[model samples]
Target: MKINNLKNLFKNNFVKNIFFVSSGTAIAQIIGTITYPIITRYYTPDEFGVFVTYSSIIAILSIISSLKYEFAIPIAESEEKAVNIVFLCVGILIIYSSIIFLALLLYSNEIFSLLGNEHLNQYWYLIPIGVSFIGIYSLFMYWSFRKKEYLAISKTTISQSFFGNISKIGFGFLNMGAFGLIFGDILGKSAGITVLSKSFINNKCFSKANLSEIIEQSKRYIKFPIYSAPSKLLNTLGVQLPVIFITLLYGSSVAGFFGLSHTIVSIPMSLIGTSVGNVFYGEAASIGRKNPKKIKELSNNLLKKLIAIGIIPLITLILFGPILFKFVFGSNWYQAGIYAQIIAFLVFFRFMFTPITNIFSVFERQKEELYLDSFRLVLVLIAFGISKYVNLDSFWAIGLYSLAMCIVYFVTYIYAQKILNDEIKKI
Candidate 1:
């Protein structure tokens, strides 16, 4: 009877939506988990380093590719308004990507040379292509979130993983090196576009998006471009800069090890954190105006659940990360496991706090988020700078980085709680 009651509780709409997204993310992660060992064997750490550098650049750029107006879609007032926001995001994405492409063409030599990775010069064109695909996918993703099409989103996740992983293996066999990894990623990102586009084309709401409406919505949500975009960009930079710094300072091989560790640690974030965040954002947006107290309740419940779900895996990694990495990804990757151990606690805090921090956006507190993200970036730079000053090894540098991030995430969690409490007080 107790088990049946628990099952019924899990069947609620919020839980069901999380299940749809998480199950899809789980399948996608499982595919990567199974293939990563093979991938590690096929690509040397140096190659992985180059791939990570390219990916980090793309990730930082993609954060603002649409100037973050797509984020307004889920919280927009009406279907018509949301549709216009999507169109606005698309227009901005095209212009932003084109600008990036032109800039790269004019300065590819200098950019690649500064990064100390001449290998990326030949593949510079793919950066803009990647930004476009990621930006478009994000626009569609938020639209699906608004419509509560979790199943469609899930399907796209699975398709992307399947195609992307298979392509990576194929390209690796061809010995295309980092280009193969980069191209495979591009393929994976593009794979789900057709599936996600169906929601837009089939809905009559899209036709409501006119030039005037787009302009109106753009101004209406002007804070997204003004504040949210920079916040998100800084957040991404805080995450991706380590990879770039490691590549520049310790060399690509060390960066590759760190990248692999970070990837493995981030699986839980991708699998559960993102799923919960999507559902939470959708639900919170709906309830934010009507019943703000419920947002507090929901956030508290999610924090507890995230803590319980994350503790065991993170603890296991901390204790046995090196062993697992060696056994799974081969002996050469043993160092990656050590890096994972150093960052496991950081990932735990991140996994617990990151999903719920969407409340910042939910409450339209983009400036606060921007401030926190700026603090995070400053801390990261200091951590790396201190490491270089002392000539600390990669492990110690990562440890310092991890400590800084843990502090920031904890502060973020407290701030989110304060925001929720303050919202309730206003009533």
Candidate 2:
């Protein structure tokens, strides 16, 4: 009877959305994990380092190409302009990456020297090669979210994963090295875009997204790209700082361990937390605007769910990380167990905090969200610096970093709850 009641309780849109988003990505990540062993067997740490570097550069470029507008698109008032903003972001990314490509061509050696690795210098060519299509897919994704098309969202993710696995294995066998991963990344995104493009672009929603509307919409959130560009750049740098520190202090080998362990451990977050957070953002925004009274209720409900559902993955990682890494990804990845546990405990804090952070967008608390993220930025910097100077192991540094973040999350939740209460009292 109790189990039946619990099932009935999750019948609402929010619960269904969470299930839809999470199940698809969770399955996709599992497939991605399965493919890891295949590639890891063929690639050396140094070769894998190339994959890591190029992937990171592509990630950074995607962010730059995005101009952070995707994050802000939901907040825009005009749906038409929001539609155009998607393409606008795409146009800007292509233009920006093209310029970057030209410059890299002119100063390949100088750029490689800047990265401290000549090998990584050539991968810059892959930037324009794949980023254009991938960038388009990213912007279109925001459009899907803004339109509340969760099922389409789920389908795209599944197709991307399926194609990604096929292309990765096929290309990896061709002796293409890191290019295989790059191809997998680009082709996956391109496939997703192609699948979803017709529905999104042809919808009545975007019909209103003509040039005049684009200008007005662009004007509305120009500050986003401006402040957000460098903010996101710094934030990405902050994320990768540990990897950079690992390389500087310990060399490419340890950095490989760091990257691999980070990836393996971050699975729960990348799969579950991100999937849930994606839906939560759109859901919170919808409720805040239409059903203002439900904000706290939804927020608290999400916190409980995150804790409950999140624990299963955490236990799996803590228990099976070493064995799985050793057998599947080879003995070298055994250290993944230790790092996975540390990262999971850290991600646990993140999982709890994610829904609350989304509430910031709920009540139009963008500034407050920015402030909290800034606080988090500071904590990440301090932790990274200490780890670097004191020469802490990757385990210790990551744990410290996660601990600082957990503290910030709890404090922010307390404060946001209080403010929410005060606002409700006046009602």
Candidate 3:
């Protein structure tokens, strides 16, 4: 009887889908994990700082490149509408990236000076290129999600990780400095586009998308741009702003340490949280319309499971984060481990809340997310302000930041539960 139950569990589609996605992410993260030690040896913290700052800029811009219309792809009512949304996203990406490139070309020095990292002025052109690649990859990845093409998505994840990491190591050997890290990242972002594009061509999705349909769908999903895009931009700001602040206040080496710690701590989030979140988003959207109560049940169960999964990592980091960083990354990165310990609480809560928060988009309750994310960003700024006011070191500033974010994410978890309850009551 137990064996039969186990076999049946394996046959379940949701479990199967998550397995495929998570396996790919697991392999990709493993490759990255193996290469980090080597990469760290070749590049200094200052170089890593520069790379992190450049990445932060790209990440913030990429959030709104399509005005977040790609988010509507999975929950779109029909294949035709979904395909049109993809074209809509790609079109917006081209225009947005072009604008960014032109702006940088004309105002590179002024912008870099404002950012307090004029070192980026030399590579200003790469900003738009990075944003474009990231935007394209995201839109297609969602299309894959809508089609239930988990295996294809998995292959692309592996391809991205393998090629990107290999190139980073190769460039490190050539002593290419921060530019190597930036270019390698751009290469990784581009690697998956070709494979994702095949799905579009094979399905004749390209021919189906027309300007009229694109405009119609854009209006149909206008809320995504109006509410979801800005909300997501603020959320990205909450995540990426610290790097800028650290760079401005403490310098590149400190930002590098912070960046490395963030990278290491976010591994579980990338590996499991994102994989499960993608699958959960697809599944929840399917189930949510028919049974709002089921969404509540599903979210509660996921929260419990996430808490269990996160506790071990949290405890491990608290106890031995610095030691582990010294041992695994290098002795020079000992400070990063200290930062990791400080932020582990935030990462843990983030891992739990992030996957489940798709309930907002699933139900079109983006305004609540916008409001909450606004508050979250404010809290982050307050943390930084307090740290700066008190003249604390980067370590203390990060601690205050983590503590503040933990409170907001916990509130977000509660609020998400309430959103689910409110939906259930409406039924």
Q: Compared with the true structure, what per-residue lDDT tens digits does model 1 show for residues 370-403?
A: 9999999999999999999999999899999999
TM-score of candidate 1 to 2 decimals: 0.98
Question: Which residue runs does candidate 3 get wrong by more than 4 Å?
Answer: none
Q: Count clashing residue pairs in model 3.
A: 0
**Candidate 2, residues 1-427: lDDT per residue as tens digits?**
9999878967888888888877788877877777778877766666556566666666666666777777666656667667777767766887887887898899978866665556776566777767777777777776667777777778788888778767877887887776676677677767778655666657765555577766776677776676666655655655665565556555666666667777766665656777777787887666655554587787777788788977887898788877877888888777756677667776676677655665554564555555665776788789878988888876787778767767766877787787678667767
TM-score of each: 0.98, 0.88, 0.98
Error of 1 at 341 (Å): 0.5
Global lDDT of model 1: 0.90
The candidate 2 region of ten consecutive residues with least summed lDDT is: 360-369
lDDT winner between 1 and 2, please give it.
Answer: 1
Model 1 stretches astray by more than 4 angstroms:
none
